[model samples]
Target: MSDTTGGLLTIAALIILLAAVHKPFGDYMAHVFTSAKHWRVEKRIYRVLGVNADSEQSARSYTVSVLGFSLISIVVLFLILVGQKALPFDRGLPGMPWDMSLNTAVSFVTNTNWQSYSGESTLGFAAQAGGLVIQNFLSAAVGIAVAIALVRGFVRSRSGELGNFWVDLVRGTIRILLPLSFVAAILLVSQGVIQNFGDHTVHALTGGTQVIPGGPVASQESIKELGTNGGGFFNGNSSHPFENGTPFSNLIELFLLLVIPVSLTRTLGTMVGSRKQGYAILGAMTFMFGAALAVVTWAEAGMHSQAAQLAGGSMEGKETQFGSWASSLFATATTGTSTGAINSAHDSLSPTGGGTVLVNMMLGEVAPGGVGAGIYGILVMAVVTVFIAGLMVGRTPEILGKKIGTKEMTYVALYTLSVPAIILVGIGLAIALHGTPGYMNNPGSHGFSEVVYAFTSAANNNGSAFAGITVTSHFFQISLAAAMLLGRFIPIALVLGLAGSLAKQGKVPVTAGTLPTHTPLFASLLVGVILLVTGLTFFPALALGPLAEALS
Candidate 1:
């Protein structure tokens, strides 16, 4: 009926749908990873890759496999992108420049689809489907594999082995992502998402001509959201009618981006034999997500600025089809998770609203982050929280019966610092260079925010941009690519190393002094740890940017 009613319905339906599927989908994923028997097709894939399906890997071996696989994927995809002009379904597009190709390759391979160019104008079907879309599935599977490996570390005792990386990757793709994406693609196409091989021209009633771009959008759109990979088939991303189509499809996309990450909490509980522990993590995520949504909705709807008042709301960059409330909901979902699919322009959000989303990313997107990334990210925080609590109580911290000793805390510390380090260092370098100012659309505090948002998005592997800065220069392309790669692999290596160390330890017995991490108290502490860490590290930088703009 009304936008407000539709927005409320959309929010209610999303929560209900996610809750309904949480257990079944999560348990299905658990079964997919842990089952002993493999499909004939999976076995064939193992043979092709020369992987020993029955064998397991220690954390070191698993980390090496992950790094090696991602490196190779980046190179292959880079070549494919640079050579796209000669590929089938070229669509008369030229090959991407070498730097942009490298950036795009790193972006997709890292599951951060940060685009500096318009997708329809820059990439052909061959590059879109064969390179970007394929990497979308593989990269997301890699993240799932890593998260499960970490889970195995918690589940096992006195063992160095996590699991077979190859098995996890293939099974995640074939058994989970593939089937889900197939169904989602059909649904999106039915909702008017384009799925074709060619573009055509059309004439307007005013006698002007327009070229409508078309591709296998529905297919790519499904995995892009389902996998939490945010590369859009169009420059307008989910805001484009052909990609998102309608309010119903927009709601579906939001649900798709969130479902896996939310369900993975259930998967964690199911696998670890502790649903309450999973609920603790889920509760922390839900609280932060709800808080961000509220702040953003209030800020946008209030329209506090003089210009915003004249427009009636913060409606400048939002689509008419989805009003301020719906757009704010989408913004919250996209930023809260690492989905990065936007139904509205984040750059035009009220200063307070924009700041909230920025902080959401700065909190490492653990308000239910990317597919495999969120579970592990929050789990790392959990370990840190436990360690802090243990120190306060003058007892050694243990979670799920595993001791958070020196080695584990070291890995946790590195994991905690890695993304922030990348973001800060990258931003410093970008701002120090005189050429950076040329890229900004504004020249004051708002301009500073654009720079912070770019590196923040890149380093966190969340691909959404503030849209007020141009990042197509060779400097931006290469540097942001480096940030994406380092931000992604460093933490992954540390996570796997932590999993290995934890798996090597024998479980400690819980005693009267032991802290229960699955309670509301623990969830609150976890949330506090997230906020404390992010605020401490990024508050100064934020004060100079969105904080300054919002106040002014």
Candidate 2:
């Protein structure tokens, strides 16, 4: 099949699958969060953790619980990574260096799987499975829990309570993530993703020995994509044949990363007692995603350069099994969703194509962002939209009957500004440091793009790299770790704060002056606000890097 035809067909199939599953899966999630009866196992686990699931928490308490749990997770995972050489499944690999250990630990704990080391060479099965994989589940669960709490902010009236963080976290893992990951793992293994415990050596066609590494890849791959964690069991990530063996598996991984984020919109609508609101949010997300996919695909397929034309397409750094179109799709999906698993080397994308994905991350990945992150991210945008609309219309801003007052907007402003601040500042610092030039593999606009991409990915909790820069130095390591940590928890803390503020307000009855947020107009406004905010903040950086390269 022609690449264009194949790409179109694959996209069609993906949309159909997403549509087929959206309502049922989204509604099921709503039920999962709202259900009164807890599973026996959940109760036991809660007891062991000293959590009173039945008791609700105010926003402050919930935030503390989340921060405390994640801090503990980081420390524990750090020790596991740094001490992995002593473990039985070491695979003859030494423990990670102190700085890299801290970076990896913070990366996984924050749900940003930004790796500075190759997975196969740097980690053993014990670290990959016992440490990283466990965080994949919990960190994702934490994001979903926060999103649910934010939803509660909209649903409840005149109350400070947003559900218990412990309850949401446990239920999200046990009831939602676990079963889905189990099924996905089996499907991936059936599709030829490796599921073994050791490496094997083979004779190469060049009469050389090759060591093929193997691990419990299927198990890790499932949760990695499903949770939107995106750390690869092998450094090649989804591009590695053992992790994503075929065209079908590639599509599956893409679907796994995107499904939860897309479906959570429906959950938002259901929980708010207005499916139209969810549809509005979903509409905006879909529009952004589709537009982005088109731009990257067009850019890659155009074959603008002399070399690309000679090669018949922009084939450099893309997997042969998955041509430019599919690679473009993967790039768009990975960046747009914040999953960051690259099936193709993002650094080798055409300048335009590269710029689009960078813009995707700059848009905060809310074009259906990461698992729990997307829903809340867009909701914050929606609030900003209404606030703008209110100013325009000379009326009070409200959504789902809750007023977007000064306190709420304070949280929204900080939530919106924090990540961009981290991204830009991080890039500026990296560029100014004298030793940074040594890290550049490409020395001009492309090099600038690489630094921008790294910090953008890290600060947004997206975790994909542009692949040409070396970030192993202490400065890059610590700075990127700080970016990941702040990029994650700052917005989360603010979102929870917004939730608490919203929860305290009594629902304002709908009236003639009230703005209808569930309409197409509102979705368009939300999209505009997202674009305006991102463009204003990141356009200068883009112009300096990708835009300059593309134009030149």
CA lDDT of each prediction against the hidden true structure: 0.92, 0.93
- Tens-digit lDDT track of model 2 for 1-552: 787899999999999999999999999999999999999999999899988889999999999999999999999999999999998789999999999999999999999999999999999998999999999999999999999999999999999899999989999999999999999999999889999999999999999999988899999999999999999999899999999999999999988999999999999999999999999999999999999999999999888654587888898888889988889999999999878899999988999999999999999989999998999999999999999999998888998999888899999999999999999999999999888878988879999999999999999999999987999999999999999999999999999999999999999999999999999999999999999999999999999999898888
Candidate 1 per-residue C-alpha lDDT over 19-137 given as tens digits, one digit per residue, 9 for 90 to 100: 99999999999999899999999999999999999999999899989999999999999999999988999998899999999999999999999998889989999899999999989
Error of 2 at 475 (Å): 0.5
**For this target, which candidate reaches the highest lDDT against the unseen true structure?**
2
Model 2 CA lDDT for position 43? 95
What is candidate 2's CA lDDT for residue 17?
A: 90
Off by over 4 Å in 1: none
- Cα deviation at 223, candidate 2, in Å, is 0.7
* TM-score to native of every candidate shown: 0.99, 0.99
